[model samples]
Target: MTHDPIPARLAALKTTSTPDLKSQWRDLFDTEAPPFNRRYLESRLAYRIQELVYGGLKPETVRRLERLGEELDGGDKRKRGIRADRDRPITGTRLLREWQGVEQIVTVTRDGFEWQGRPYKSLSAIARAITGTRWNGWVFFGLKNHRGRA
Candidate 1:
């Protein structure tokens, strides 16, 4: 019968030193080791070893995961690493408000809000620019009631 070296190699990872693990990480992943803890190294090493023998995740699985991540963070790579707040409207949603007989329209974007071809980090800034006074953007935009109800 043909011999399998994967089990022995995987078992050896448990007793491997930190330095050796880092070296192995470099060799297997073809890059520098991350600044993570020992457990992270061991787990990643174990995964890498198995990946080398059994292959990696299927392409469809990877695509599905990426699609899910995009839905969570609106496909913003900077926000991809962190959990984003869900209170904001989805991208491309238009927020409309009328002030002093003029209609103001703001479009929600992945990064922030857009009003009159200008990008704003917060609704408050847009409200200030429109009124030259401090106002809660959510309240001014009618997104939240003065009593804090949505």
Candidate 2:
């Protein structure tokens, strides 16, 4: 029968020093040893050890977590809608807005949005920088609207 190894891993995590933790991390994760704090290593290694022994979360559990995340982030990002919107927009199709008496403009790029000749990660980042607060980029630029909340 398969036995649970969680208890043993937990015990080792509590006793291991920083250098020992690095070695364990390499053995477990098979990645380059990181230079992290002892507490950080302990917590991460503890999590990984349990993840290995007990296996990962269920698919339903992951979906529930994703939904909770979307709700918390105030986005109901439908995959179909996102794909359709992305495919429809051509590069250089200018998105324009006026905020606080200043005209704001952004150009759609093959990879991402561009503003003032600078490549931006998201339009929301530009919106936040322009407004000095969190404003949904899609709503700010009239690309999308809050359809009765998430």
Candidate 3:
């Protein structure tokens, strides 16, 4: 009888140590593991292992999924929009706002925001630093209106 190694590998994830899981993540993803919880790593690693063995979704399936997404959002990002993660801009986008006669530029990064050569976890933090007062970062950056319009 042929032995299936996939089952054993997956079952091992539950008992694997944090360091081991990270090592496995590096091996499977060819990069460092994200700073997420152990459950997130295990779930992603499980999916990646299965995907590597059985292959990922088909190209036609991918296209169909994309079409479905567009249908849900009216195919126009500016029209219906996909607010999957709040209203954060896409990574690599640069936001410009003039504050007190000086133009403030903030760049969107994969992890967070970058402003003035400093990395910030939230826009509110940057807004606080910029104004030295409590301000809604979204409104401060013009991402949202006073009435909460995106």
Candidate 4:
């Protein structure tokens, strides 16, 4: 049997007071390229309405959405405010220069060398062994005396 056209079925569905009809419409749009393109175009019209109704999102929320989009599109996954170059020891020196805390020191036992007042055998070993998500400030700063002299 031939199926009823989507526009007619959608019109019929609209007469009902079901909240889920929006989602059903979305699903139908996903299945049909023409409907999908139409809905995509129509959604742009609602952008201003959404902004007006929601009173616009906060700056932080907008940033989060941008970041999420980047991640979804296989772009950068790094968090904002985190400098990409700062992940390396050489670049992290700036952070070390700014902070005056002994806690910045991370001890390395393999190389038997002190880094930022903590001991470490080699940078590679430190990189390999310290598998945490946090930034390492010690390696970049180099060893400093208790007086804070590098």
Candidate 5:
């Protein structure tokens, strides 16, 4: 004879009381029927096995669920809307920097060259201030220049 597991027994009890719980949840929302609340309850119940088997709550698991919640809560929709409003292609500009030292990213744009979070308003002005005719590229594509010869 096989013994029923504690979790299995608890789960059966929880399942049998779902309708009453759902009614209470719906009442809390001041609605005769709250589909969203019922869905939330279903999701919570689905994670019961993890909560029962694991001694402690997992931070990574919670973080992943939080990220999913953000996406489901219209975060991605807002980002897509913002991108659509911009209507400009993202520049293929790259950043050159060192991992250990403070480096300035210089972008040559229509307005001018921006360096270290400041706009120079002219490339000539930046060239005149830097002392060298050519500057080495340090960081490319978010990675350190391993060759170090740049």
Candidate 6:
């Protein structure tokens, strides 16, 4: 009968402690271990062991997964090939619009927008304050269209 090493290795993982897990991480990854907690090491090592036994993902597949993750997480402004928003104003950008014969400006923040030295929950909130009515913030500032085109 053929032998299975996976169960034994997983059992050993449960028996081993945190310090030993770091050793395992180095043995498996062959690099200086990250300062991650025990559970992280255990899970990652389990995946690695299985990957070694069967096969690992293709390099191109891994790159695609990483790019998808970066797109979902709003990383790297110039990674538009990853489908990052093409025309969205960057964080810390200043947007200006004229309403009622007055020029108003808002500054972009990582989480939200700011206007008149005050942090706002959304651009729509700022638009409501400015126009005294409901307005699509992106349309008001021409960042995107009322129909959601840039």
How many residue pairs clash (N, CA or C atoms closer than 3 angstroms) in each of the candidate models, in the order given?
Answer: 0, 0, 0, 4, 2, 0
lDDT of every predicted structure (CA atoms): 0.93, 0.81, 0.92, 0.45, 0.50, 0.86
What RMSD value applies to candidate 2?
Answer: 13.3
The predicted structure with the larger lDDT, 5 or 6, is 6
Q: What's model 5's TM-score?
A: 0.23
Cα lDDT of model 3 by residue, 1-150, tens digit: 998899999999999999999999999999999998899999999999999999999999999998997898778867555346867899999989888999999999999999999999888899999899998888999899999788
| Candidate with best TM-score | 1
What TM-score fits each model?
0.52, 0.43, 0.51, 0.22, 0.23, 0.46
lDDT tens digits, residues 1-150, model 2?
987667786887878777788998899899966776688888888888888877889899999988886876566666425534433357889999998899999998987899988998788899998999998887788877676221
Q: CA lDDT of 101 in candidate 2?
A: 95
The lDDT, on a scale of 0 to 1, for candidate 1 is 0.93
Q: What's model 2's TM-score?
A: 0.43
CA deviation > 4 Å runs, candidate 4: 1-36, 71-150
On the 0 to 100 scale, the lDDT of residue 39 in model 4 is 49
Per-residue lDDT of candidate 1, residues 1-150 (tens digit): 999998899889889999999999999999999998899999999999999889999999999999998998798899876655667898999999999999999999999999999999999999999999999999999989998667
Q: Highest lDDT, which number? A: 1
Clashes of 5: 2
lDDT of 3 at 37: 86
Question: Which residue ranges in model 3 land beyond 4 Å of their true spot?
Answer: 76-150
Clashing pairs in 2: none
Clashes of 1: 0
| Residue-level lDDT for 34 in candidate 6 | 87
Cand. 5 Cα-lDDT: 0.50
